[model samples]
Target: MEQFYTDERNVQILIALLKEHGIKKVVASPGSTNVTFVGSIQQDSFFEIYSSVDERSAAYIACGLAAESGESVALSCTGATASRNYYPALTEAFYRKLPILAITSTQDESKIGHMIPQIIDRTVQPLDTVKCSVHLQTVKDAADAWDCNVKANKAILELTHGGNGPVHVNLTTTYSRNFMVKELKRERKIERVMTYGKFPDIPKGKIAVYIGSHVRMSKSLAESIDLFCETHNAIVAVDPTANYTGRYRVPYMLVAQQSIEDENRNPDLLIHIGEMSDMAGIVGQPKSVWRVNEDGKIVDRFQTLRYVFEMPEHLFFEHYSKSLLSRQNTYYNSCMEKCNYFWNNIPELPFSHIWVAFRLHNLLPMGSVLHLGILSPLRSWGYFPIPSHIEVYCNQGGFGIDGNMSSLLGASLVHPEKLYFGVVGDLSFFYDMNVLGNRHVGENVRILLINNALAAEFHLFKQTNLTKVNEIERFLSAGGHFGCKSLDVVKHLVEDWGYEYLTASTKEDFEKVYERFITPDLTEKPMIFEVFTDVNDENEALRRMYFIESSTRYKVKNAVKNIIGEDRMEIIKKIIKR
Candidate 1:
């Protein structure tokens, strides 16, 4: 009779689990400790095994195979320093998110301190090298067999779970020489599904969808989302970059401004979609966040991620929306009411970046596109509503000041006929000043450069901690990095590049030249409207805006303080106390 493979129970259980999960490709490196595993699987015609003498080359081969085949590949190696050779390739797989499984066979770990020649403790790999690590116990009895089977399944499943990466399974074997087992032992198989196979039941409670920076959605997807919001009594909150023009788009600025006290506006189930968003500063605290993405990774942006629905956004929203009863629009109405109230009660002030945004909010031509810089410019314009036809774009992806002008220039190239306006702070403007010299800049591109002489964000009230640091002027705020602070430096540069340079220092100067800058009539050259404002007025304008968004009591107190002046109000308070 023909001799069969080894009857080692742990090896049999692991092989059975691997086959059950449809893992058919096994890359085996020559070794003694893994002889039983290799020899057994080699006999099983179900697996197509490839032999490699070098463990390092074997790992790269498996990575290539998994990448091309779009299937998980398993690499098996013997004990000693053989598994260490997999470090370089495994590190590449980990970073690339390739699903490679490294199965290292060894003698009992207890033999490590005994100076056993061929044993190395691979209890753990380097940090983030693998998604997870599992140590398989020797299968001696039914309990041990079941534990081994479960662990093997878990290790394999983890290879493609959450975010795909490599996983390690260190199997302990006794080197049994019995090679007469004809049939492998039957074992239970565990399967994990990251994507939704069917529509899950919608959670009962207030549901809200928060969309981050995303490209424009198709009309059908927008309509479906709108229907979902209508049917489920849900609202879709978005920052300006969300690019969604759906009816359910809530006034996020008002919601963000009132986030401190709006308990009802907070969603019990917050479904987050899209990429990163800067609206975390504005949205109310959520009780739970359910992230929907194809990657299925657990992204806890709100510190309340309970479920990760790994699927396309439209499918998840459409399915979940169908299973809900309609909810009241009270939350939506309250948000709009507060937004209207703030817009009406905003205080007019001295010339500043925000003051320009307030004045030009209604004046921006219909159907024009607005591109804003990352920090101060984006935040300032977000307070006012833009025409629905007007699309807004910003560089919040890397959130750096380096590419603001370059990105706006690229967009202008695509739509040369459409008017494009970019609002940028002086730091961002100067960082990408070379783009201004580009020959492709057309007459349709207009820029609003807010030159406050320094990085005003470092001087905001909330950033008081940064301001307290020593040498903040040079290091933190980037003061005096460029030459002397004046528009003369900018004027000389832009005039040589064929730009219509316009300067505004006071409101009178701004009103005189602002109309010509915003006019739809195309200019012979691209224009640069540089508005110079004092740092103190910019800080005070921001503080007063926050006070306006505060509670009714604060609004009343601010009004009284403005009417009576600060010194007289303090004196009256002291007199009342006496």
Candidate 2:
């Protein structure tokens, strides 16, 4: 006999997570909007469900069950006055701290204020009614699905968080009649842990710690992470902004996606720390991701989140370092071997941002501070290595292009004796160029503005890949702005502002001025090298660095994708996977 579930993505995710969390007892009230959720669970024998004609009675019954069993009990109700009836019992559960989950199904949220029949505004709930609330909309894309997963996990986790109380999950349904979908897709379950709480034992497999853009690294935190990586046979994938000086730190984000097929690339257990970097899906597809943040919120960036350790990152690493579970560095060695291979095999690229970083990264003065602007510069410099003593910063915590120059100026103020470098694109440099006039600006500032005359990031990579290259410049890249790379625009300003400006239009020009820009000594005036290049050359450099020309399989897959479209290609891939 075949089992079926609702085709609605959000509903399916809810059902899957409920099963994963083992909240099998359900009290369901009869209604149309909630039919998909109730019907799907009713068919699954794993759920022991009770029915009630009154929505108010259904919620009280769930509260009673949860109180008696000392476990979570789920309640479901449809739209209109039916969901309003659950407030009294939810209030009681909230005060008494009973573990109950109230799932109220509703029509599209857009219909709420239009005076449409059966649509009510459930967004504002009484503060005491539940401990937490998360409204789940229909899942549309990977990001939306990630939201649904995190919210569903959050709602479920609230049942046991702090004390225990009822939580609301306002689910918007599409009323889809399709129930032919077989087997629920596996969902990510998040287990939250705190200090003095039970911790998960180390699993035997390839493990890696991925740290994102951290502003500064304390000495103790660095040592704890180093010992953990060494003890657990693991590696640390990082960006320049990660600021982790451990021996195992691999700033391989530029080449991370290319290692999808390598087993070592997809760590079995990946621990993530700090805030996000601009590189989306840079860690490849991992088996599971465990996040350690003091805030303890579920941020399922990779969509594979399984644990959220609510403590300092160093504590999480130190806790696991005492595992005493014997391990070897085989995983670390294997990944580093492939990482080095990828670096050496990178094809010769055109004179572009990546080329500039490759030529200048290692040559930077030691113990200096380096700042990279948004996406392209980070991707370029992240591929190369700087000295361990050089600290790195990027505006990626906000992931904006507004304050690259200002931030560099601020950092250089305190460390006037040490050199500071700002590597930014033209748009970002001009956007925050006002910082150059500040009286506190120091002579240690070395700015390298890569002026392609537009937002070169928007013109390359997976961004609107099907859009024509020429058309991209018109709108997406916002080309023909920013003085159109006028040689004198920046030069005139720098000279008037009492700073040295060097302009370069070709590789030879950059080579000729390289020595002056990277010289270790502090100069009388701050210096800037505004290197100009063509957007076509930037795209070429990215294509070569990503190894697009060498991947015949990727070429064929993309060709098929362009012909059949992404949706159909996804279906074909799913069929092949099956």
State model 2's lDDT.
0.85
My TM-score estimates for the predictions, one after another, are: 0.67, 0.85
Candidate 2 residue lDDT tens string, 109-215: 88978989998999988999998899999999988898998999999998888889999999989999888898999987889999979999878787888888886
Model 1 misplaced stretches (Cα beyond 4 Å): 1-158, 161-196, 258-260, 323-328, 481-483, 549-578
Query: Per model, how many backbone clashes are there?
Result: 1, 0
Cα misplacement distance, residue 300 of candidate 2 (Å): 1.3
Per-residue lDDT, model 1, residue 247, is 82
Candidate 2 TM-score over all chains jointly:
0.85
Shift of residue 57 alpha carbon in model 2, Å: 5.9
Residue range with the least summed lDDT across 10 consecutive positions in model 1: 191-200
